[model samples]
Target: MFVMGHNQLPPHLKKFRRLVYISPVITILSLSLLVWTYSSDMTFQFITRYYHATSDPQTPVQFTLPLHRGPGQMGPEEQKLSLMAVNGTKTVLVAAYQEHRTGQKEVRIIAVVLRSETVAYRCLLRCQEQLRISEGVSTTHSDHFGFAYGTADIMCPLPLGCETASHVTVISAASDSNDTQIQEFLEVKNQKVQSDSFPYNFVVCLSTMFDFTNVLQLVQSLEMLQLLGVNRVVIYKTSNSPETQRILDYYIYKGFVEVIPWSLSKFVNVSRGWLPEHGPGDLHYLGQIPALNDCLYRYMYQSRYVALQDMDELILPQSVNSWLELVPLLEMKYGEDKCYMFENNVFPNTVSLPPPTSQTLPPPSCCPGWENVSGVNILAHLYQEPIITETHYTNFKIIVNPRAVFSTSVHGLLSSLIDCSWVDRNIARMYHTRASRQTELTEDELIYDGRLLSYSTKLIPNVNAVFRESGLLPEGSIQ
Candidate 1:
């Protein structure tokens, strides 16, 4: 096998093979060296620039952090914000004695913070005089969605005629303070008893309503409100059925109801209950707390008194004919600035209606085909259930002077600058008509409360008229 082979190849051929291997290695090393040199030079330049920037006093240095981590963060655009003016002047007019005092008005600013450092507010009041005020922001509460409810108070002094000032420019404070432009303009109107007063004396502020399909009950409720002397009713609507919308439009045209478009579903996942433990809404009950607060401010100066209640509930006076009569009597007994609380009385909707006797009045119907509607028949539910002692039976609702109440909750006002009085249940009570919370309550447990019977005659015709006008019923449906 030992014969002349490639091992004994010519010297020229062997030299070519060695050169091929060595050439590639040399190329790789040269490229690597060039890259290292370039990187080193860039690093040196960056260090030198940074050093000079820090060392020189004239050179401006800028630092940045994540917006959420930063001191003053600009929050999401969808965050709800509002401001309202309260008449700071107090005038006491007694029959025999009179006292008058004039003071600077106060501005209440509310900001719903989703994600921002709304730490302070800069308010500019431009009227007879240009006044600027700065106030620190404070969070009253927060919901499961991490929406921080914040408020700020600003004192505003205006010249005599400037009482009708419409707007105040407001801006959130920033870390890089360079006099940020006004982000929002808050409405400011004199709520005092000037030459012209608000047309409506009482307004019912309903909490946030979501996916409301109760058309029949809604109409009935509206009719009851009219009978109760409610001049206006404001509902914060998140969503509703087509039927409900049509009914609302009818009331809106009649100037009896105002619907505030609530578009919270577009931004966050809305939950049905107060806590997300049950479901997936961030703010409690479709941002109900905020809506209630907003309603208070929205009608603060427009209505003399505001009743915070649900659509299923009605605060009825046992002796008086209407709230118009009840409010005056209440004020005389409890004073003007006091918040009147009414005892809650539950009337279960599951209970069967009383048998139609000669004295019994026939319950009004919504329409022929609408007998099996989605909502409960409020008229059929007149059986008052015995109050459960362990539960918060004594839970109450409030009718407040919007100017005097500072903050509000579901049951009542959290704090009021004025006094609060609990009206006796025998005098006036809240008729809450809804599904029974308890699983069992016999006929013996239910008692007859005929307070609602008085409003039936008027309520039936009003509901029929509203349905007819809205085209929900025939044109001659009232007859």
Candidate 2:
């Protein structure tokens, strides 16, 4: 009866039955279209929530809230600030800011990408118009030391030259449609939005410290840096021992060490050495150059000078007591707008000065309980490898006016208008304490340098105090 009803039904009833059958299919199609529409609007909605309405011909930023991304659409801005790959390309974006240098007049994203292009990218600015300008998206790659994974400045020039942007998002335009995928906007930094005096005089950058367990030396180094007039120490550390973490946390509480997360190996196949022969990886020195460059720009306007050095070394003033006394002399001798290169005078661990006979004599090198700490004591090693005539003035580390330098490298400037000069070793030299580079040299052949001993009177107690603060050494350890 039910099967026969459709053919035997009255004319009016038959039409109504057919309408009911087709309506459910129509409803399903409508819901699918609604979901697609909402998905496309997520980025636009995420943006419009923060930026206020503006119709100015200049079309600068109207306003900006705390820079955050929409949920479930993409991954969270991870707790670790590692390199972010741009939409599945080799191009990994580290940061972005308005370009005031080189007069390029664009927004430059500091990134890790192939030296040559594999894909096209563009700027998706959070402007009044919600602008998408893909025409001027060019690539400026800094192939520092001919390393395989060079740092690229993915350039996005503004059409109306708006430098007042509070933030901007970058996207890959190589897709079938430019609007398919989007990356979160990094709040524009180094903006120079307002002119003011720098907060610090000297800032040091120690990059790519991996698996560090040098606790005693790290404490001694920071104490020495403080004595030498460094206002800030930026450490881009990959990982460290649990003991070392206590020291870093203490220093951070003391407002000295800034530990930037550096997990480049997690993102790229980072090479262990600087040369090409050290391959089976993508970047050099476990991504050292990018970390250095990031530090430079990060502190470009915050500090008057930035010194790039390793954790195990310090650039000490030979004649003067501290860098406050030394830098003025350097400026007077070399003139301003100069990249001051100090010769790396290696203080070999293999050669040590004779121990003091008295607690107060031969310099105050006695510090109790630090002996139990799991790291080298930088003070004990005083003798240095004799400077080689062939390599004289060749092996160097730099302290430069961050604004004067255009591109920075491991040893020195890759490109800069600033001239390079060697400070006389008597004036200042890098006290590099590490495994001996000249393994052939005997004890007598090395020079006896006691410059570090000069700081021992202060360094001894300072080391003990840090141990106390970090809970690294037990009580009754401080004298």
Candidate 3:
């Protein structure tokens, strides 16, 4: 070995050479190690948004390490911990860290749950190495599985069904408390949805058909819809039938229904496609039938569900007595994004008449039992001077998701996006009282009537000419 004294060393360069080579290597090595450790152990999280399908409420995201004890082997002095969420589904990602009881060296493990698109439920745990020194011999230890437990439970949407599994892709990390990589597990690539549509709890639009003329039955049906938790009702009257007007007014007075005047004839001019034109004498059908479509178009834009029908038709109850009871069952069985379809059954003679046209009235205590009497009650009662028979009865009705309804017609139309199911038959019916006292009309009344003017106009073009020539609107009221 050769030894040199400080005096023999090169005074100008020795110190600089030593400093440049050693210090730079040390600094570079320390930085490289720090970068590797940070890249390995650092984790991230993000905040996301969700919406309620049926209601307008939005849930807030709360983050914290849960207080539950983790499952697995643990040291006598060490306490294990895990995380959980409540109210809504939660996503959790965990990283492990260890510290020596002596020198206090630190080690960390980074983890990520790879699956989380819009909504998800899952947990991730990362294993970390622990270091311990005994008798001057250094020993390193690593856990096979991270020292944590507890899992995420994901909440799925309505009409949920199993599908083919796809690989979970981890996305960019969110720098929050979740400490997991956010990813999209489910994707709707080309979902086509209608825009600018009205959403309502339920919508029922009434169209008057000159059948049975049961004003009382109409009021009861309106009340029943209100009791069923329907928030709004639109009565589309084509004919200015005094009795029908009275029934609508009764509901309006009670703050239950809204009456909007519409003529079927003007509808024909404004609506061209899917509407068939009527000729001279057949104009009655235009006012009575096509009025459904016209009124629905005006009112259904803001409703979530819609039912269109004549005054005689009513939605009866089967599984549940009222709509209030049925909504929850529906939410549980079909989820928030579902539609219900009701089949038509005719219940004749549920109405009792010479009924007043307008007024608020209660539906019968029980569904009418047409056990024995038949032969069209309206005709039987009106034919006799005493009017012995009753005419108050329910006919038929259809239930549907208003949002899923596409076109309005006499029968109506529902879109295919909805999951359709049948309602119990005994609960509701469509009573056809057309063959009774309603079939007859005086030529003058048909020609000069203002009551049926709107329906006549929508269904019958130039109906104003007939009414005007007949001296109905007098020239002053005519446009």
Candidate 4:
């Protein structure tokens, strides 16, 4: 019987022992070498810089993620997002993000392209080894608001074993010519989106602000929204009066508003009206549909629900006090798929003050402190157009679950798993306090609902505080 001893082993055994002894030393030396390499200038530029997509891992990388393969210098500039125009095509890329909800591993690009333009899109996925080019499935949204330019979704499926994408860009392909044109790479969002990260119960999406100077109404409406359970309001602003910007800034400072610069005019001439024939522009309402879609994706994982509304409008709950209260009741009845369509009951801004209500009318608005303000006073107009008692109405707004929606319109959802169920006016309705589109209706035709008046007590004080803090109102003017 032959046995092996530690010191008296065979030559191969001795060699194996020496190797085992040096293994820990080799491992330690390798680790130390790595640490030294990283800690010193010996580190490769590609290795350290490309480790994280962003400096602050919690926040997303803005407009540009550091890569240099695209043709353009950069695209449109909103605060932290990009609006890139594809070369030799009418296609404009608003934002690109990894969408996991659709059961396809793809980069969903929200864009505004011509309804009939046969622009073939390719998704340039920033992969680990190579820039993957995948043919994108383009879907031009149905609700284009009768405009030439419509909101489209370019779904580019990710390559095999690609768990996450670094960044994404869209390229225009020519059928006649074999050359594909690539634009700038946009920060692919929603991959790092922490679901329910914030406590915003309802987020409001005001499509665009074009030449807006309505200060008084903006304040009242913003305050009213806050009171009605809106935690955050995302405003896509093109240009606004300084006074209006100040109000927007105040909300932004308060962390209640996100102002995304709407620079669609830089790329395409945006139409002032819904139809292209109504003006000499290309897209409708300053690329509002794209903005709405971007807003949807932006907050899809951030909030429970999103309300698409105008600055002058508020979707007030009739039975419930706040939207936080209202949405749960709706979801309970509709099972999370119903887009809570509220009847658009316009309260004419033409009326100086509504007929006196039972509650003491404090100058029909925020008391006497708002006379110098430049916008509409929502509290002043309590009477609105009579609710259309039918099952549906043409003019209506919606409060929707962002996850359930794919594409959005100014008034409703274009593509949503969410079915439109007109919320009973008794449950909730929209107070669209704009210049009367119902000018044909007589003064007597308008109904004095006084529903908005119920919130005037708290709204007035809250508004007064905002005005006083914003220096919009006189310090001692409590009259």
Clashes of each: 2, 0, 36, 3
Model 3, position 428: C-alpha lDDT score: 33
Q: Write the per-residue lDDT of candidate 2 for residues 1-479, one digit (tens) a residue.
A: 01232367688867876778777456656766665566535745544554434344333322122222332111112124536666746777787667686665677677777665567776766555365454425444455456667776677776675645566656676644545344566666777832347898889999687888988888899999999989999987777777777677667655688878787777778877777686667787888887888888788888888999998889989989998899888999998746899999888765557744443347444777877888788878887888888667665888888887666778887767788888888899999988998888888788777788888888887777677656677767756
Off by over 4 Å in 1: 1-106, 114-135, 139-172, 175-179, 182-184, 189-197, 265-269, 355-373, 392-395, 476-479
TM-score per candidate, in order? 0.68, 0.78, 0.35, 0.78
The digit string of per-residue lDDT tens for model 1 on 1-479 reads 12234477579867875768777456657866665666655765666578767775533222121213221222222123332222121110000100012344444444333334323444445554554444433445433334332222233343345544445544444333444342345555444542227777889989877888988888888888888889999887766776676666666645688877666555445568655576665446676766777677666767888899999888999898788888888888889846998888888887866634654655444345446446777877777877667644455788988877666877776666776788877778899888776658787778777778778777766665555556665454345
Q: Candidate 4: misplaced stretches above 4 Å?
A: 1-78, 175-183, 192-198, 353-366, 388-392
How well does candidate 1 score on lDDT at residue 211?
83
TM-score of 1: 0.68
Better of 1 and 4 by TM-score: 4
Worst 10 residues of 1 by lDDT: 91-100
Better of 2 and 3 by lDDT: 2
- State the C-alpha lDDT per candidate: 0.62, 0.73, 0.36, 0.75
Give the candidates in order of TM-score, highest first.
4, 2, 1, 3
Top candidate, metric lDDT? 4
Clashing pairs in 2: none
* Whole-model alpha-carbon lDDT for candidate 4: 0.75
